[model samples]
Structures are given as structure tokens and as C-alpha cells.
Target: MLRIHFAGEDIGRVRIAAGPVPAWEMLLSLHALRGPADHGVFGPWRARTLGVLDASARLLLRLAPPRGYSPDFLTPTADNDIDSLVDAVQSTARRRLRTDLGLLAAQRGPAVWMRPLADGDTTALRCVGTAMFRYHQRVLAPAWDRIHAVVMAERAARVADLLDGGVERMLSRLHPHIRWEAPVLSVTYPVRKELHLGGRGLLLVPSYFCWARPIALRDSGLDPVLVYPANRGLQRLVEPPDTSNGDSLAQLLGATRAAVLQEIGGAEGVTGTDLVRRLRISPASASEHATVLRRAGFIVSHRTANTVWHMPTPLGRAVLERDSGVRAGHGCQRSPARAGFTP
Candidate 1:
């Protein structure tokens, strides 16, 4: 279990990122790509991404294994813009690079190619930056609009939770695996760990690529953040629109539940009372449909005292957009060729 100890003032300092962190998304998506192909949601995305990767993309795979430690310098403090993030990685301080690379070596043994990186060679850093930029342009950039929409939807839900019930309520509802009990917030993790936020608070970053559990920075001294999966937006990132499955949301969720999703998506921070009155349904029926939508990753519910607010997730919004003929098509573009990274 990972336990995060919070100071009294830390609660007030907690924040939810308004959008995705491009660098973190790049790194985390690499990890997802390297994972098992049996993933039902991400399998299609993996296949599409793998078909387009250039040789230099392998450099990133070595640094970020499917499971285990990834170098901290690869992902610096939260930067939403991909260009700025690539710049940050390329301009990483030599001392920081050595420290992070040394840690990676200690855990997974040193690699011949990584030796130059550990020594902070300028050429090595540039190659890494090039690979990152290519991967983003080729793999992530096409789907960025969808990715941003999903992440923002998650942020909207979380922000409503924070405003409705403050830090404790928001923390408590982050995930089923996460638990908030006053001064400490505990999370299910592969390894046992503890983080004490000595009034630095914590940044809650919503990620479309984070798998099942929340991940924290290995170096606790840095500004702390917990990147949690933003309610399974993988299908949006991977799958193409299929008109064959017409009104699929209604078909899968049933008429009433689909209606519930549509109504919730039409507005922001809709309360359960609003559903009851607008839909002309009993409170129990509204609650039941909302529960079904929440469980399906179509919506998130934030409660305030007696009121419960429901907001649509990206998946839900996409479904509605598709039905309404409002969804836009984006084309994939290859990254401009650059000098290759040679060992």
C-alpha cells in the first residue's frame, strides 16, 4: 500500500490539473504500449501505434519498461504543452540526468547505450528528445483532441468534487483502490511506499493512459503528484467510429440509462434532483441509472451533503457526439524525419 501523509495546510493546497501533462502522457503511454496485448480496451490502440513507430522509438522503450522504474528526468514537473516538454527533456540538467539514470541503472542494471545518457552527453539527450517528439507526433498527436477532451472531462468532474466536499471528499473518491482517512491517504500499489507532503500538498493529474492504479513520483522531494487513470478513455484514443453500431450507447445502456447519460452530458454539474425533476422519474430510478452510468465510466458523481452532481466522461460525450453527427474526423500525420539515434 502507498500511504501519503498530509499536513493540515496541505489539504488547502491540493489541486487538480486542468488538463493532461504531455510529457507524463508520453511516458505513461509508452508503458501501456509495452504491456500485454490482451488488454481489451488498449489492444487496438497498441496495434495502431506499434505499426507506425520508427526505430528511434525503441530508445524510449528501454528507458521505460512495461513494469518498474522510469527515469524521473524523462518527465519533469507538469508541462501541458508537448513542445515545452520536449524542450525540458532535451535541456535536463546534467546533474539531474546522472542522478536519475544512476537510479535506473541500480534497479535494472546498466545498458551500454544508456551509459552516454548517464554521463549527460548532449548528443544522447538530443536523440532522446527527437524520439519523444516523433512518438508524440506519430502516435499521440492525432488523437490529442480526443485525449484533451477526455482529460478535461475528468478534471471537470474532479473539480466539482473538490468544490462540493473539499479535499477529503475528493481524495476519498479518487478510486476504489484509494482511501482517504484524515491525515493519511492510502492507495493500492505494487510496492510498499509512504509519502509525507510537508505542506507541498499534492497535484492530482488525470491521465488517459495510467492503467489501473495511481502512480507517484519516485523522488518524493519533488513537487508531489498522483497520476490516476481518468476513467478508461482508451477506446476513444484507439477505436475508429463505426456507424454499424448505431445508437450504441442506448443499445448498451438501455433507453433509460442512455437518456440519463444524454441529460447529464447536456449540462455541467447536474444534480440528482435535477434528473428526478427533468426526467420525471422517481429518485430511486434516477439513482439506479446514474449508478449504472458511473460504473460504465460514462459519468462521475460528486456529492455535496444531500445533493449528488453527475458529469459525463469523455466516452459518454463521444457517444453522444457520434449520435448527433457532431464528432469530427482527424487524420494521422507522420513526424518530420530527423537525425536518427545510433548506438
Candidate 2:
């Protein structure tokens, strides 16, 4: 188990990443590609990425092991910008690169590439950075629109949790494997370890492809970061239902309410403003319809940062499926516009 000792200041300092870090996602996605059997959700993506990677890009696989230890410099922070992250990796301090690469080599056994890296070769380091950038463009850039939307929705949910019950509640519910016990947050890790925050606090990052368990930085001396799996519902965002039986449901619920339900059903965790924009209706109309749907138990809405996010309940999905005679997972294609959303 990994025990995280938190100071008082750390409580207020706790933060959620606004979106996925491109480099981090690339690293984890590469790890996922190594063992497709372990992560079924990413099966399609793994196949697609495998078909594109070249020998040079494949070299980056050495930087991340399927289990345990990845160089810290590869993933700078929670920043969503890929160029900035690539810049950080390329400009990493020679000593930091040597130390992190040495540790990675030690854990996974030395690779031929490590010789140049350990010698503080800038060209070798830039090669690794180039590989990471190429991998990101090939594997993650295409899906970034869907990825960003899901991540933003996740952030909205966590922000709601923070608002509802403060930091403790949010921390406790971060993942099934994590436990918050006031001053210390314990994580069931593959290896036994303890991290003392010493009031620097922790940055919680939600990753769409982080797999089953939460991951933390191996060297506690660096700023603390915890990358956890995003919600299961996020998987649906990857292949959003194109069309729903909204016409039939619209008859039962008014046209507007049915349209709202269809949109909520198509994508879970959609905000009222999102609905307003999609439906081309006023905010008040969207909120009113959503409230009625919530009262009828078709959907549930949670308010976070003054914005309300709506998601269909099982019954709501059932109602739409039954009414439309269109089963879940079968729908129209997603609009190009729906593919991206600002977080």
C-alpha cells in the first residue's frame, strides 16, 4: 500500500487536472499497447496505434514499462498543451534525465539506448522526445476531441464532489482502490511505498487510458502527481450514439424534453450549457426541461461551479431504447462539431 501523509496546507492545495497531459497519455497508451489483453476498452485504439508506429517511435516503449517506473521528465505536469510538454522533455536538465533514465534502465534492465542517454547525450534525449511527439500525433491526436470532452466532464464531476463534501469526500471517491483517512490517503499499490507530501500537496490527474489502478511518481522528491482511471462512462464518449429514437420519446416527453433526453442519452455528463448550445435553446428552457426529466427519474443533474451536468439514469436509457426501438450502442454518426468542446 502507498500511504500519502498530507499536511493541513495540502488539503487546500489539492487540485484536479483540467484535462489529460498529452505526453502522459502517450506514455500510458504505449504501455496499454504492450498488453492489449489487460485493457479491453482500448482494443480498437491499440490496433490503430500498432499499425502506425515505426522503429524509431517504438524505441519510446523502452521509456515506459508495462508495470513499474517511467521517466518523470517525459510527462511534465497536467498541462494539456502537447508542444509545451514536448519542449519540457527535450529541454530536461541533463542531470535529471540521467537520474530518471538510470532508474528506468535499472528497473527494466539496460537497453542499448540507455548508453547514450546515461552519457547525457542531447541528441539521444531529443530522439526520445521526437518519438514521444510522433507517437502522440499518431495515437492520441485523432481522439483528442472525444478525450478532452470526457476529461472535462470528469473534472466537472470531481469539482461537484469537492463542492458537495470538501476535499475529503472528493479524495475518498477518486477511485475504488484509494482510501482517504484524514491526514493520510492510502493507495493499494503494486509495491509497498509511502509518500510524505510535507505540505506541497498533490495534483490529481484523470486519464482516459490509465487502466485499472492509479499511478504516482516513483521519486517522491518531485512534485506529487496521482494519475487515476477516468470514469467508465467516458468510454461511451469515444463512440457517441449518432441518432436516438428521440422522435418517439419526444411525443411522450414534449419535443424539447425528448430532444434533451436524446442528447443526454447520446452523451452522459452533458452540461446544461452544452444542451443549450446543441439544441439552440435558451439556458432557462434547457434547465427547465432537465429539471422535469430529473423529477421524473429519467435523468439526474448535479450542479458544479454553477453549471449543472445532466446524465440519464438507467431507467431513462431504457425508456429511450424502448420507445425508439433502437437499442443502446446503435445511433447516428457524431457531428464534427460535437467532437470537440472547450474544457
- State the lDDT of candidate 2 residue by residue for 225-300, as single tens digits: 9888774453522332234433333444478888999999888668888999999999989977876665555665
lDDT of 1: 0.79
User: Candidate 2: what lDDT?
Assistant: 0.75
Off by over 4 Å in 2: 37-39, 234-258, 261-343
What lDDT tens digits, residue by residue, belong to model 1 across residues 1-343?
A: 8999999899999998878888778889999898777687677788888999999999999898878889888888687887888888988988888888888888889889988887889999999999999999999998776677667666776777788888788998787778999899999999999999999999999888887888888988888989988744343455555565454445444777777888999985477888999889999999888866655557666543355667776667766766554223233332233123110
- Angstrom error at residue 279, model 1: 4.8
lDDT of 2 at 304: 42
Model 1 weakest lDDT span, ten residues long = 334-343
State TM-scores per candidate: 0.76, 0.73
Top model number, TM-score:
1
